[model samples]
Target: IPKTPLWKRCVQYTDILGKRLLKKIRLQYLQDNLEQRRTARSSNLLSLCRPTISLDPIL
Candidate 1:
C-alpha cells in the first residue's frame, strides 16, 4: 500500500490550533464580563443601604 502525504498533517494541525485559540478567547471574555457584573452589584447594594442607615438615627 502507498503512504499518506505530509500536506495532510499540516492542514490538520492548523485546524486544531485555530479551534483551541478561539475557545480560549471566548472563555476570557465571559470571565471579564462576570467580574464587571459582580462589581456593579456590590456598589448598588452599598448605595441602597446608605439611605436606611442614615435615616434610622432620626426616626
Candidate 2:
C-alpha cells in the first residue's frame, strides 16, 4: 500500500468541492427559471380570462 502526497490530496478535495458547488448553483438556477415561467404562464392565463377596459375621455 502507498500513501498519496499532501498536495494531491488537497487538489482532489478542491475538485470535489468545486463540482458540488457547481451542481448546487445549476440546480438553483433551473428552479428559479421554472418558477418564473410558471408565474408568467399563470399571469397570461389570468389576463386572457379578464377583459381590459381603457378609460379615455376621447373614447
Q: Which candidate tops TM-score?
A: 2
TM-score of each: 0.40, 0.41
| Residue 36 displacement in candidate 1 (angstroms) | 0.5
Clashing pairs in 2: none
The worst-scoring run of ten residues by lDDT in candidate 1 lies at: 1-10
Q: Write the per-residue lDDT of candidate 1 for residues 1-59, one digit (tens) a residue.
A: 12333333334455565666656655765786678886884546565657554544565
- Score candidate 1 by TM-score against the native: 0.40
> Which stretches of model 1 miss by more than 4 angstroms?
1-17, 41-59
Which regions of candidate 2 are displaced past 4 Å?
1-17, 41-59
Best candidate (score: lDDT)? 2
State in Å the error of residue 20, model 2. Answer: 0.2
Task: Show the lowest summed lDDT stretch of 10 residues, model 2.
Answer: 1-10
Clashes of each: 0, 0
Error of 1 at 25 (Å): 0.3
Q: lDDT tens digits, residues 1-59, model 2?
A: 12533333344456565766656655766787778887884456545656786655885
Estimate the TM-score for candidate 2: 0.41
